[model samples]
Target: MATDVSNELDRADNVGRIVDSLDSRRVLLGALGLVGFVGLWWAGSTAQPEYILPSPLAVGLAAQSELASGTMQAALFNSVLHWLPGTVVGTTLGIATGVALGWSRFLDEALTPIVRVLRPVPPLALIGFAIAWFGIGHAGAAFIIAIGAFWINFYAAYGGVEGVSEDLLDVARSLGVQRQLGLIRTVVLPASLPEITTGIRTGIGRCWMLVVAAEIFGAPGIGRQIFRASNSLQVDRVIAYILVLSVMFLLVDTAFRVVQRRVLAWR
Candidate 1:
């Protein structure tokens, strides 16, 4: 037993070392890619007018100014106001609805057709209804973002539930877990968690992209900042806000992935 345990530990240590080496190489390559991209951008900016393509330093200065003036902070706060609520509501409802439809033959039969029809409708197409219903504010922007998140999560959860092992469910039933809710809670949900989490991660990224579209009709956010700056020929400011959006997405994604790794540690 001791020999087996030592062998396992050694194998695990080797795997960890390999992973760390790969991660280090990945970081180095990523840094090189970023440097190449920045060099290209600098060369392009030097050839173009500032109004057409701002230099990296100009965009950085603009970002610093926005930060110093507190406009960026306010915009970030407002963006979060809608982004958070929309993502939460959409993810919750989508998972519930998807699980129901996937688990129940009747619901699947009744709703699959309707879902197929509605699935292709673009969230942007709802901007008019959002304006009319929620009226040019955070609520309206959230509605649009929710639509985007809903579809992504819905498909993810539905597929997850569908892919659950029949043998596992049968084993649970044989063990006296017969209640529908109990079966779902103990077996179905745990089995489907990976796909559901993947959906959530994807939904988060898509919703971030939708933030810009959501704010197209006059909501206050980074998207609004970009719009306003673009209209005034402020290319530097526009690039600055775009960078802000990129950084925010990276931060949120990194944070979520950390939590996801912890949650799925058993895997």
Candidate 2:
């Protein structure tokens, strides 16, 4: 028993060491890559005029000016307001529908073909229809964003549910947990959580993409700012907005990762 305990402790120590090593490696590699990218950008910018390709400092100054003017904040908030509601509603509905379809062959067969037909059509392709139907406002942008978020989440939830182990189902049955709802609650949900989390992450990314497109096409948001900057030949401001969007995406991705780690701690 003492030997077994010692071995277990040694194994745990090895795992901790491995995790630490990997974390350090990742940080080092990421920093190196970032430095290379910045060096390249600086070199390229220096090779051209500010109007052609602004220096990083120039772009930073432009961003600061926009922030000080409050236009950047207003545009960012508008985009977020449009995106948040649609993403929440669409993701929730998609997950619920996906779970139901995955759990029932009859439902899956009925809906799969329809979804397949709709899924291939890009959200941007439907913008004209959105404008006509919802009229180039928050509603239209939200609708477009929802469409993008829905498909990603639906497939993720479906795949996750379908991937649950048959042995888990059998074990639940053997334990006299005979109700379908009980099985879903006790076994299916827990088993499929990781995949669902992945889908939500993907959906969030899609929402960002859609927000830019929606704003570019007459919706009031950051994409509009980008569009205006481009049209007016304010390349530095355009690049600044792009940088801001990229930063937002990074922050959202990090937030999701933290939430996933906490929520799926058992895994």
Candidate 3:
């Protein structure tokens, strides 16, 4: 028994080492792939006009300058102002509305056609309405962002609720949980959490992209920074601003993933 235990311990240690080695290899390969991409981008930049394809070094320098001057910070702050309220409002409304429709057969039949008809309308088309309704400030930009988030979250919640197991719900009803609200609160929400969380994650990313489009008019954000840079043919600055958006997205997504893992730990 002692010898058998020793052999199992050795095997486990060997497996752990092998897993660590694989993880390190994956990290190294990812680094090399990023280097190769930068090399190709440098070659492309050399072949094209600087105004069209600024070199990575030049873009890095521009990013440094923007950071030193505090312009990027200001733009990022403005963007957050637009992004937060819009995402929250849209997400809350969408989830609530979708849950209602999904829970009620009568509402689903009566409202789904309207949803289908409205779903095809792009957020860009509503830019005019946003401006007219909220003016050309943060509210207007947020309206556009909200619209984009609304549809994404709406579909997610609707699908999640729709996909809840009938057997599970029936079991809950038989257990003296016949109230619709009680069933939804205790059973449906938990069952559909994964889909709802996925929708929320997707909406978060989508909303960031919309920030640029939302600020295209007169709103002050990273999108406006890009516009100003492009007008002067400041390709390096444009690329730098784009990198800023990429970095922000990565940071936010990473933070959210941590929360998601905790929330879904039971799974």
Candidate 4:
């Protein structure tokens, strides 16, 4: 029995090693792919006139200059400030509303029709309304971002809550968990955490996309900076802002993944 247990343990160790090796290989390959893509971009841009496409080196230098002068910092701060509050408020409201709608059949039925009617309208389509309501400032940009984040969280939370097993519900009810709030807190919320996290992640990505568009319209952020750069024919600066935005999103995505792992540890 001792020998058998030792053999099983060795096999398990080998499997773990193999999995780690595969993960490392994936990371290595992804890095290589990104490097190759940048190389190709650099080469293509170098082959073209500066007016048409700025070389990666030029863009990198511009980005460095922007950072050194603190313009990049200010733009990044402005963008984050607009995005954070909007995301927080929209996500909170969406989750609460979604929980209510999913838990109550009558509420779902009543709201579903309205949501359906409004859901198809793109956030960009409401830019005019946002501007009219909030004026041309941070609030308008935030409103646009919020609109995008809200729908994402709403649908994700609703689906997650609706997906909870009826058997689980019955079990909870039998175990003296008959209170709706208690059931939601103990069972539904925990069960739906994974989906809710996914929705939040998606919303984060969407918020970034919308922020640029919102800024282009009238909001003061990275998007506005990029737009100004483009209008002034500063191709390198424009590319630099685009690269900065990409890096910011990557960092945000990594943070979200970390949070998801911690919050859903039970899973």
Report the lDDT of model 4 for residue 103.
Answer: 81
Q: Score residue 225 of candidate 4 by CA lDDT.
A: 89
136-174 per-residue lDDT for model 2 (tens digits): 888889888988888888888899999999999999999
Alpha carbon lDDT at 262, candidate 2: 98
Runs in model 1 with CA error above 4 Å? Answer: none
**In model 3, what lDDT does residue 96 have?**
85
Q: How well is each residue in 1-267 modelled by candidate 4, as lDDT tens digits?
A: 999999998998999899999999999999999999999988898789986888888988999999999999999999998899888878888888888898889999988889999999998899889889988888888898899899999989999999998899899999999788999998899889999999999999888888899887767779988999999999999989988888989999999999998998776
By summed lDDT, the worst window of 10 consecutive residues in model 2 runs over 208-217
Candidate 3 lDDT by residue in tens digits, 1-267? 999999998998999899999999999999999999999999999999989999999999999999999999999999999999999988888888888898899999999889989999988789899999999989999999998889888989999999999999999999899789999999988898888888888999999999999998889999999999999999999999988888888898889889988999787
- Per lDDT, what order, best first? 1, 3, 2, 4
TM-score of each model, in listed order: 0.97, 0.93, 0.90, 0.92
* Model 2 TM-score, 2 decimals: 0.93
Q: Which one wins by lDDT: 3 or 4?
A: 3
lDDT, candidate 3, at 257 = 88
lDDT score at residue 223, model 2, on the 0-100 scale: 91
Residue 147 lDDT, candidate 2, scale 0-100: 85
Ranking by TM-score: 1, 2, 4, 3
